[model samples]
Target: MNLSIFFEPLNEDVFANLEKPRTLGSYISYFVSKFPDWRAADIAILGVDETRGRSNEEQAEDASTAETPARLVRRKLYSLNKGAGRCQIVDLGNLRPGISLDDTYLRLKEIVEVLISHNTIPVIIGGSHDLEYGQYMGYEHLERVVNMVTVDSSVDMTEDPSVPPNKRQLRQILMHEPNYLFSLGQIGYQSYLTEPEVMATLEKMHFEAYRVGEVHRSIQEMEPVIRVADLLTFDISAIRHQDAPASEPANPFGLTGEEACQLCWYAGLNDNLTSLGIYEYNPELDDRELTAMMIATMIWYFIEGFYHRKNETNFTSRHFTKYAIAFTEDNPDRMTFYKSKNSEKWWLEVEPLSAEKGTRIVPCSYEDYLQATKGEVPHRWIMTQARLG
Candidate 1:
């Protein structure tokens, strides 16, 4: 019911801080152009001003302009609201001399506050994962802040000085909130986090993690774990190296290209969702066609699920899906195949006992899972299909 746009300036310092260069804006623009429906949905962008870095010849030409502001400027890019869509551009020039994190946070906070007040979900094209700290802070006003889900190859919880400045100080977000906190598809385990402390911390917090194989095994088991989530943060590193190879660690594992897009689509399908972010991509690492193609696909699927979530998104039929049980109790290990054509949601599509809805005791370890499958029976839905708010 409420919506607007905001922009964040990106530049070299931002790159230096984040350990990656700006890559999301143009891709987003391309995406909007490709799928005009999403353009009609929301408008926002974040980046640094390029005008400040204009070449000598360009600066001279600008100076020759009759208008003072035109004469002073060199280059800057803003979000284009070409039609009924609200296109808001948030771009900045070089850090004037020097800027503090406090200043940066303040600037970001102002825009975030507006989104929160309007209760509008933000689809962020990130500058750095550190921006997450500020983004999380903005949601404090909510009575219940949903669990935070971060998908990356490394634990990112490390704040090693040797690490780049803009790299996520991921450890800071690790706190027990009586909320459902989880991470997935971390592949560069040994190299990125080589300490017992990291594993111990997750164990202590009851946080579960997955390497590629493990995450896949748990994919069907994720309905309830994900149902409790409040917001989703995708580091892009969760993407395979071939798809988004420019991530901070640049090492991605778990899931194939199809699986990666499925994750984005599923995350957007959650009902209790607040916002989504895709971060840690370095355009500099990509060639023209390959790199952009991968991230572009991710965005496309993300928007796909979001649109479907707006409705009950259903399909006549899809491949049979499995909903894993949390425990091996009376319900032994098994997978439910949807023999009937029903709800398209992988989880909601399957019926535990019979082909009809409301038959068997739906398999779920958590309450959100039960709620997520509110309308259907067991084996009829994908875990992600039901658990979201």
Candidate 2:
């Protein structure tokens, strides 16, 4: 599969202008007509130039006009220092927009499918949030259930067929055929912006949607939630308008620039996450590259966390300590938990079914342990059980 045909190389002038001494540009492989030898790389970066999803919105002009978003991001990215741990990363440059918007999605889906099949993570710089639909579609041939976590200011649950996907992408993903989605989680949603009915629907479906205030209260709690996702997308508009003013849906209050980086770090640490997209950055509305720098820093943190990953998935290993807690004195059923001696991260073990060969380990916080100990089940545990059933 010659992926180069689907992508164009980053402009040589862009790289030539970057100060190469101790910068990220010196380390990463960027595509030319010849693709980088990406088989050994841990991650690949791709940029999309399609923004038809913004056409239906009132502020379509704020979306990226073809290559501007990627170009600005690349400039900022080249200036950052590579992380402490070694990581093989390849930048695939931009995917040229197709004849139609659907054509563009098809192209992205095929490219992403190839990357994931090769076990290389794709860090996407998107033209609009709806491009993530293609990212999700890439998993169709993988023959496994996928969980998606999205960082957005609002859940796009509108059922209006006339609306562009940026307004209702989540609804489309949820109803897509083959039903490969096992769960969906949303972080950094603003209560005021999201419709009450949409929130109620999320609860009814038992999917997790965290408010911005909840994340501010305990950012650590977000790590486990992010760890459960196989794919994640960060909507740039989720950051406060002051920090990330370039997004069309930008709001007065939301996650801080620092908090956005922290969430990305958590996503990178997850053993299950194989794909990530940072979407909706509009350079036209940015203030002197401030938003671009913030986004670049988020990417750097994600790569840092990726390199620092500890392979703690093996429960039987000496690296883990097990605890068995009974919910009630007379109850036969008990919850099993594992704590990593290295990272001190917690995981709850779910009961295996008849056809299952091993127990299912779900990411959890210490609070989940406390809840189970008090004869109460964590919502995560209950949701996992229902999904498995």
Candidate 3:
């Protein structure tokens, strides 16, 4: 179902989030072209608005019962037929009506399964970080894939899987075998997680992350952490509190709008980027000029990432806009880097020459580094940097 056509009034709650001076859609229409490149040809974007609240939850009453307000999914004609390559955007905001969050997730999964089986990439936009419960579930059958990345401000690590009214982290649900899930950008920590060590546990599992201070450097420097994942799962909250705060994670850590776009571009360019999801965008908390616009622009960045891969283009300029604060910690199992042949997932990959081994780069680290596998059975580390600006 195409979901981006319809325009609706903002919900009453999260009114504070919507306290913007201008409209966001307008901003998206204005500046999407001036951002990161995404792998549009290789990866398809599915924008789903399957967000819902339980009858007992606080915002349950605010959901719209509309069937098809504006369905982008319907318009694209991105079928799962043979040779169905390329990522398509599926706006779930209209596909299913009045379904529980669980059911909605299942419904989304059915569509995703169809795409994945056809060897088409699914760049999913979301209802919540919770929807991934089903996304992760669907990935089990894919043979070559076994990794998922969560780019957000909070870990969502608490364990309790009941339902809309009461649910928990993947630790509660994905219990069978260990999954290669990583969490980046749990910066600007607030009360969402009960403990600070939740971050530590995630790191222990290789769910690496950065604080507000760490991301201050260029995203170019931090690429190693996320490069390891098969799929890059982006939570909109990963953006800063000032940048895009209309989503579930309003108070995010470091990284500017450009870095977020770059990361999405990285996903779009990657060859192994099996799936991508961007979530927690609440119209309630967005400013017409800032939040929503930022989202739309970011969406363009995802596309830009893909396009660059398809055309083998370079950024207008790439001197690391956010590289001042790249700090490297004393990581025992610190990541080694690698290089790629410019074809990132959508088209993004890695490549690098022989570099001395010193673990983390001292001072502020470069965010451009990514974790790529080079050996047999398992993966080996090789350091890579983008074509110098």
Candidate 4:
């Protein structure tokens, strides 16, 4: 695909000022005079300036003034010191907004599909949360059921006609034709902000929803959930207004900046997760670009975790410790779990009902193994079984 035509080169004046030695900008190859060679890259960073999907048209109009949200984020990201990993990252430049919002989505979908087809992970920045629908659609032709993890303050599933696309994109994804979405797991959603009917609907469909308080109780438990995702979309509104004041309708209660980074780290470590999007940051509303820096740090942690992946899926290998548990004497159902010696991560094997289906390896936690040891089936195991059945 001739990608250059779809993107506008990064503003040289903004990045040229990043003259600090050993900074991340010094290590990254980005589009300025020409598009970087993305074919050999491990990860590609792409920015989208589109914000027409936002509910507040005034805010969207203000976004187009001078420094875009994406550019502001880039400025912060470039100023940071280089990570420990040897970086082969490319910045694809900001995408040119199409004549219509739907047209912009189509362009994003095409770009994402092309990058993923070459095994390059796309780390998307800027735009409204609604752009996630385009990111999800990129996997349509990949011929596999996709598991998604979304971190947001609200469910974004509204059916109200007056609601803008950013607030209702999740419903579009759930009801999209030629459905390939296998499961959706939401994290950091505030109960008061979410509709009771939508919550019940998600439950009836067997989808997972984690309340903000639940995430606060134990952020570690959310790792297994994130580990199973093929794509992840994080809205800055999931962070507290004090920490991320640039968010649309900033909430007083949400994840802390540190907790948000931890989730990104977990997502990066997942071999299954192919793409990530960080959205809903309005630079105009920011407190001296503090929110922009927060988002940049989150991206930094994700990239750092990416280089630390162990790739430990082989159960028969010497790098794993296996445990077998029989659920009950009468039930005679046995479950197997594998713990990675390299990373201490856990996974369980689910037996397939038919020969054609084959066995499935599900990401899990040490707690799940303990549940089995006590003669009880883990909820995750039950959910996987139900979904597979």
The best candidate in terms of lDDT: 4
Tens digit of lDDT per residue, candidate 1, span 114-162? Answer: 5545545555555455556555555555645346666665566654655
Candidate 1 clashes: the total is 33
TM-score of each: 0.56, 0.94, 0.59, 0.96
The 10-residue segment with the lowest total lDDT in model 2: 58-67
- In the range 224-328, model 2's lDDT, one tens digit per residue, is 999999999999999999999999865999999999999999988898899999988887799898888888889888888888889778899999999999877
- After TM-score superposition, the amount by which residue 301's alpha carbon in candidate 1 deviates from its true location, in angstroms, is 1.0
lDDT of each: 0.43, 0.86, 0.45, 0.89
List runs of model 2 lying over 4 Å from the truth.
Answer: 56-67, 352-359
**What is candidate 4's lDDT per residue for 275-354, written digit by digit as tens?**
99999998889989999999999999888889888887688999999898987778767899999888898999887566
Question: Which ten contiguous residues of candidate 1 have the minimum total lDDT?
Answer: 70-79
TM value for model 4: 0.96
Which sequence of candidate numbers ranks them by lDDT, best first? Answer: 4, 2, 3, 1
